[model samples]
Every structure is written in structure tokens, then in C-alpha cells.
Target: MSGHRAYTPSLRDRLTKAVMTAAGYLPGPLLRPVAGAPRRVDGQVLDPHFQAGLRVISLMSEGEYQDLTLERARSVVERSAYTVSGRKIDLAVVTDIVLPLGGADPDRADLPARLYSPVDGDEALPVLVYFHGGGWVLGSIDSHDATCRYIADTGRLKVISVDYRMAPEFLFPTAAEDALAAFRYVRDHAAELGVDPQRIAVGGDSAGGNLAAVVCQQTRDAGEKTPDFQLLFVPATNMSARTRSYELFGDGYFLTRGNMDWYERTYIRSDDDRLDPRASPLLATDFSGLPPAHVATGGFDPLRDEGEAYARRMADAGVKVSLRRHPTLVHPFVNAVGATPLAKAALSEAVGAMRMALAY
Candidate 1:
């Protein structure tokens, strides 16, 4: 009863914070209190929040990059949250093929994308360019297998899930560039790629959702063909540090404010970097002439307020906007698979939205 409230996140959130709090504070160098480091960690994984705090302090102390390294955080986060155990790639549509997009590093650079079809590669189908969520830090096409497959199989469309560049190493604009490059690649070879040029749409959840909106906005501005519709699932639309949601749910919902700080620091360079419209779309002055869009917000996400605000602003700017607020789920809950009922419902609604986008 103490956790119950007529608001997003609900008891689930209070419990997480309670747990984090129960863990007892560690010095600024042993965050999370893990048993031991993994045998072969490719990046830093904190056992304690303060350990992360220590790293930040040390970075500042050593005059190093005091900012967060999403790349480093992701190494630990994937182990806890984003790691997938079951099927990594499930293509329910026509037939699924995982193709390698051209990347500089064959082992690392060549982006891995999945092609989901409603039918054989012979027919043209409406296409969806999907980017998955992980705060641009973690998550891969494999982590979001079910959702993308559901979209292609149930929505009766072709889907392309992009494995965009993430943070720390290829920071901001790189992922954005990858998103655009993937779209352009799909557009340039629509016929050969088995897509209908006019029926293409862009979509993703959380960070991916942000990329989706950015893709559309950039397309319109660059005089490129716009996706028929845009689907944003609990998008992290505005990185501005001033949103009310940031103050409200910043410390809980399994996505702590510290975590966000970690993610954003990895994504952008400085406060001045926030000025880059590419970093925060809400910072953009003109939302006019962008494609019709649907922006979904998690009532509990720190990014929720900005997501809805962006949608309303879009509507006000004359872009066809459909906004839905799921006041019961937490950020990235859509990727929680079937664990949470609300997540299931959100997933269904997301597929339905994508179907609508293709229908139009």
C-alpha cells in the first residue's frame, strides 16, 4: 500500500529503489556489489553506483573525461538487463535473413541488420526500418527479435532492423548517421531490397524511437522521401536535463537518474553538445513538415514528459501526431517481453501502430 499511487511506475518502481537502497552504499568505486568481474569483460561493469561515482571522481581528479561512458556501462548492463537467453533472431514474417551492412570493421563495423518479410523476396512490401532500445548503449537486433518478428509477421510487412553504432566509441551522430545510411541504403535498393519506396516507415523503442523521429525529421529537411509514418515507442526524445519527469522518476524504475547520466554522458560531450538538435530533437525549432508520427510514452520514464511534449508540439506544428501515454510501465518496459502484462499490451499496441503506419 505504501507504494501504490495513481501514477506511472507504481509499486514496481518503489521496490527497485528499495532494493538498490538495501544493497547499502559502497564507496565511490564498487557499484552494484557483484560477486566478481566476468572472466573476459570487454568493458567496465560497476558493482556499486558509488564505484561509478569513483570513476567519475577519478576521471575528474585525473583530469580525464569525467563524463559517463555508455559504452562501458553497457558492458555491465547487457549482462544484467539486455542479455538474451532464448532465441536471438526470430523472423516470423515472409522469411528472415540477417545481413551484414557495410561497416568499416568486418568483425565490428559492418552493421548487422535483419530483413523480415511478409512474403518471398519477389514481391514489394511496405518496409519498416527499426532500431532497438538500450539508450544507445546496449541492445542489438537480436535482443529485440520477438518484437520485430511480431511486426513483420502480424503487421504483414517487411521489416529491417538496424544494428546502429552505439556510444563511447562511435558516440552521437554516428548512430544517427547509421540510421540515415540504413534508410538510404534501403531506399536506393528498394526494388532489389523487396520494398515499396512510398510505403517505407521508420520505428524503434526508447533510443531507437528517438532515432526513428530523427530519421523522419532529417529526411524531410534533406528533401528526401519521408517514411509513410513514424513509430516511436517510449522515445527518449529530449535529452534536455530540465524535464519534470527527469526530476520525478530519475532515480527509480530500473533506470536510475545516475544511469541516465551515465548514458547521456556516453552519448554526448558537454552541455553545449545538448544544443545539437541531433542530440535532442526537442531542441529543434521547427517540427513543421515532418512525417505523420505516433509517439508513445512510459508514464514512469524520466524521458516520458519530453516524449509526450514532443508529440504535442508536433501536433501543434501541424504534423499528424498520435500520442499515447502508458501510465503503468517503466522506461524500456516494452522490451521486457512477456514478464510484465503492461509490457505485453504495449508491445501489441506498438505492432498495431506499425501496422497502421504501413496501411497509410
Candidate 2:
């Protein structure tokens, strides 16, 4: 990565960032009373700062994703990323490249990807093919740019953020196919991409995380090479059924049950699709021989239970796996890293694990 110009925040983005930063400094005693009684569930208490932040977020929200039209939902998510994503960290190299979609019709557009490296050089570095999470319908490379920059800079590795096609327009298997295609392209062309062929990893957040897990399982079943590691952040592992977390935290948290229902309805063609391993990796019967994995979940997130369950299942099948629950965190914590100290710490911890896993 070569030195690049820093990102300039819009006035509103700066204000939102300022408010979130200031909230982090407020005493828990002060926030708890203001945000209401401390919320404790599943033996984890919500962080007071996040409790206050969510209160403010709810006050400002016009509507949840379920209430908005497709175009409006997409626009809101894109804009929301800037408000919470923190300032983009400067990297040595950040460039955009097109990835050819494997097995797609000639007329279909190629995947758009952004490659991020912390240091500029010809060194063949370990690389992570990252997918942006938006419930399989809402995010983009640009939306996740700041997080990728943070991971590349902090983890001291290269990150290629894949802008896989989204739902309603593309649907479930399409995103999974694109994820597999992107990982294969990186592995096969590692030298050209300035990455080590033997050290490639696949990762993503939320829906993207689901895709990463699917890619690992898909490759293993097909007798193809799998990535060296998998990095999942607040991943939704099972779509077939809602877990206890959904009943506990789904409504009030940023990711609501209604919103999840909308995402699933839009991304999946039918109920049967939810049971497909590619759509719901947890439903897969075999987890043996999958690559080592790091699955991080928010204690308050609806997807937390499933993500942890997936990790445990993988471990039971003899795959080396680690699961870290950020007790006070919520879903989409990665986007808050720039403004939230705890969130930033959590991401750094996960990225640290990634670095160690891929270290030469």
C-alpha cells in the first residue's frame, strides 16, 4: 500500500462521529440512567455507552429497513456507513480492480473489488478476500472501505474487499457463487496480486461472513482448495430458523427481526433455499476438514447464538476454531470501530488473530 490522501468527512458525518466519540467518554453511571436501566441478558450486560448510543440512534431513525423501499434502504445503509465507519485510515496502497465472475454468462458484469495494502512493495503478502455485509442486499465495497483499511493497517496484511452482487437483483446462490469465484481468482492469481498462494484467507461481516463460511464448506465438499483461514464478524450462520437471541435482542437492537425477515425474503427465492448449506452454513451436516476459523459475535446481536453454534460444531468436527463474544457489543460493531473504543479494540483483537493465523 502506498500513501494515499485521507478521507474528508462531510459535516453530518463529522457531527455523528463527534457525538459517538463523546458518548464513549461518558461515565457508565451517567449513561445508564439516561439510556434507562442497564440491560442484562444471556449473562452479558449491554455496554452503557452503546446503550446510550442506541437510544440516540433510535431517536434519529426515520425507519428500519423493513419499512423502507429497496432503493431507500440501500441509500440509507450507504450513507449510514460514513456516519459510523470512523475516519478512513491511510494505507500504502488502495486500488480498485475488476474480478471476472466464474461461470457467469459473458454478458453479466464482473465483480468490482477494492484491494488494500498497508505497505507498498512487491512482497507477496498473506491476503484476505473480504466481503461486505448488508444482509445480502445492502452493502458495497465503498461502505466497508474504512474497515478494510483498518484491518490492512492494523493486521499488516493485504485486503481485497469483494463487491459481490446483491439480492432481489441477483439472489442467494449468486452471492455465494461470486464469493467462491473471488476467492478462487485471488488464490489462482496470487503472484500477480502480490499475495501468497498458500496464505489466502476468506472473510466478511454479517451476510458476507455467511458467504465466507459457505465458501469454505463448498470448496471442501467439491474437493477444491480452501482458504488458509476464515474471519467472520457477527455472522448469521443459520437462516432456516431464528435462535433465542432473535427473540431476546432482535427488535430493539439495530438489526431487528423484521429487518432480517425482509433481507431473507429479498435474498432467498423460497423457504427451501434457507436450508441449503450455502445459504445456511449451520444446516450443513459435515464440518470436518474445513479451514481453521475465527468467529466473532456480539453478545447482544441476534445472530450471536448461531455464529457461536457454528464455531462449536466446527471445533467438534476437529477443525481448529476460536469464538470471541464481545459481551457489550451489538451487530455491525465493525462499522463503529473508528468512533467506539471497545468496538475498535474488538476488531483489532480479531485482526490480530487473523495476522497470527496467516503469519509466515
Candidate 3:
């Protein structure tokens, strides 16, 4: 006791700040050696950075957050995403618009959308109508802002983020209807949106991905011109949730079987609705005449098998299909770009795919 120094909060705070600042200024090449690359582990190529991030998140969460109700989960996940995603990047031009809900009686008061364009663009460009992934229950344009920005900037195209109606409140077919409506709205007003009508595509992630697929199906059924291309990221293609991937990766993964069960029950009106192509696109008898497709899946995600199945079905139906599976990533990895190097790398690949598909 006689030789010991007294504890000082101010000194400790200064020391912490100095350490963080020093680490922040380290060169990228110096940090790259510590970041490490993806390596094989148990038949999966796991990125060390992602694994470390998952562990930190698991420590911070996975406890004292047992309630999975819609309200509670939404707040927690959104905050988590915002914290993990850091800051939003600045695009050349970003704007918000209200899309008029068309058809018999117009509901212009409902739909809201955001548009993102590359910083280097000034002329008419290709466009993609994008939906946000949240199992038809959770996410929004704000949640998928970074993902949309990545695609828009990387592809040098205008990207429209549609705020579609979600489940329980709107129920089945409503989101799909909104997706198609947004697509049509954009196509009809492509000139005003500074995009070429003939070069427009459709895309989404998870539930959003499902909506994009349903939009193509509905377009074909309605005898309307289909989108030039479609991009789906770990989409839930089937409501049945009976795939082998469900059994293998359903529990420990970020997306669980129980959550899917809840989402289906909340979104579908009845058991019969599960079989409807509008709810489960995988059950559609015909996959013909849809746009060229890009389907991506995370190997550890519960929806992987069904997404891959849908892609295969499209390919067999003569639709040009490209499927990419990230064997070690979990669901929603695309939204984790700021937290994990692996996710950032995967997102780059996805954005590149869109650039090619959109011909930008």
C-alpha cells in the first residue's frame, strides 16, 4: 500500500483516447497483416475479421435481449446495424420522392422512396428498383441505405429504394403489389428519374429479394414488359421452410427457423396462402419469361437451399441465372460491410455483378 499509486479516472480516459487515436492512424498495409484473409475451417472459408466481429457482437448481445417481438427486435436490430455500419457515404446526388400508388383508386399518401446516383454521373443511366430485406416484417430503406449506396455507386446507376408495406399490417401480396407498383412507377417516369426505361432492373435482399422475384412473376402474368435483370440476396423463396438447409443452419445462424415460422404466420392469411405463388414463388408452376436473374446465398443461412432451388428453377425455365454462395457468411452479411472485411469483399463482388448486369 505504501508504494502503490492512486487510481485516476482522468488519466485513464486520456490514455484510452491516445491508444485509439494511434490505432486509427495506422497505415492500411500495416493493418492488413493483422486482418488476415479467409481460410478454410470445417468446410467453410471463414474470414478472421468476420469471426472476430461476430464474437464481439455475440458478447454484447445474445443475452438480456430474449424478447423477439416485432417492436423490441426491430429497435435492437436497427440500432445494432447503425452502430456496426458506422457512417453513410456521400453519393453524388441523393434525393427522396413519394411514389404514387397507382391502379383503380390511387393511394399517393402511402409509398415513400429514396433515390441514389453515383457521384461521377450526370446523364441518363440504368436504374434498379430495390426492396429492403427484413423477412417481410422488419427492415426499411434506412436500414439498407449503405447496401443501396454500394450498388448505385459501384454500378454507376440510379437506385430507387422502395418503402413497401410490410406484414401483419398489410399481409401477403401487399408487399409484392407495392414492388410491382414501384417498378411500374419508375418505368413510366424513367425520364424524370433520369434513367432509361429499357435499362431498368429489379433487386432486393431476403424478404425484399422475394418481392423482387414476385414482381417479375407478376409482370409476366400481367403481360407487361419484365425487368431487364433481377438480383436477389439470400431471399426467402419458399414459405414452407422444409429445405435441408433449414435443418442444418436454422438454429445457430442469424436467421432461425423459429423466426421464419413467426414471419410466415404473421404474413400469411391462411395455410392455403402458403401454397400461393404470390406468397411462395417457389411453388409457382411457371418460371418462364422472367428477367435474367442473380441469386446469392449465405451457406449458413436458413434460406440458402430454397434460394438456390429457385435459381435452379429459373435456369431450367430458360432464364439466365447466376448463383453465388458465400459458404462461411451468415444471413444479412451484406449489411455488415462496415464491421467485417469479408462482408465488404463479398459486397464488392455483388456490386460488381450488378454493374455487369445493368450494363453500366
On lDDT, the leading prediction is: 2
lDDT, candidates in the order shown: 0.66, 0.85, 0.75
Error of 2 at 350 (Å): 1.0
The 10-residue segment of model 2 with minimum total lDDT is 1-10
Model 2 collision count: 6
Highest TM-score: which candidate?
2
Off by over 4 Å in 1: 1-109
TM-score for candidate 3, residues paired by index = 0.84
Reference-based TM-score, model 2 = 0.93
| Candidate 1 lDDT trough over 10 residues, lowest sum | 1-10
Q: Model 1, 1-360: lDDT tens per residue?
A: 000111222364445434333333333224333423322111222223323223332332312122435343443333323221212334534333434456575323445677887576477878889988877777677567657766776577888988788876677877887787778778777898878888888999888988888888788889878778888888877776658777777653556577667668878877787777777888888999988887877766788888888899899999888788876556776555423334556667867776676574
lDDT of 2 by residue, 80-137 (tens): 7777776558899999988866445753457778999988999988899999899988
TM-scores for all candidates? 0.73, 0.93, 0.84
CA lDDT, candidate 3, residue 22: 43
TM-score: the better of candidates 1 and 2:
2
Candidate 1, residue 333: how far the Cα is off, in Å: 2.0
Q: Please report how far candidate 1 places residue 56 from its true position, in Å.
A: 28
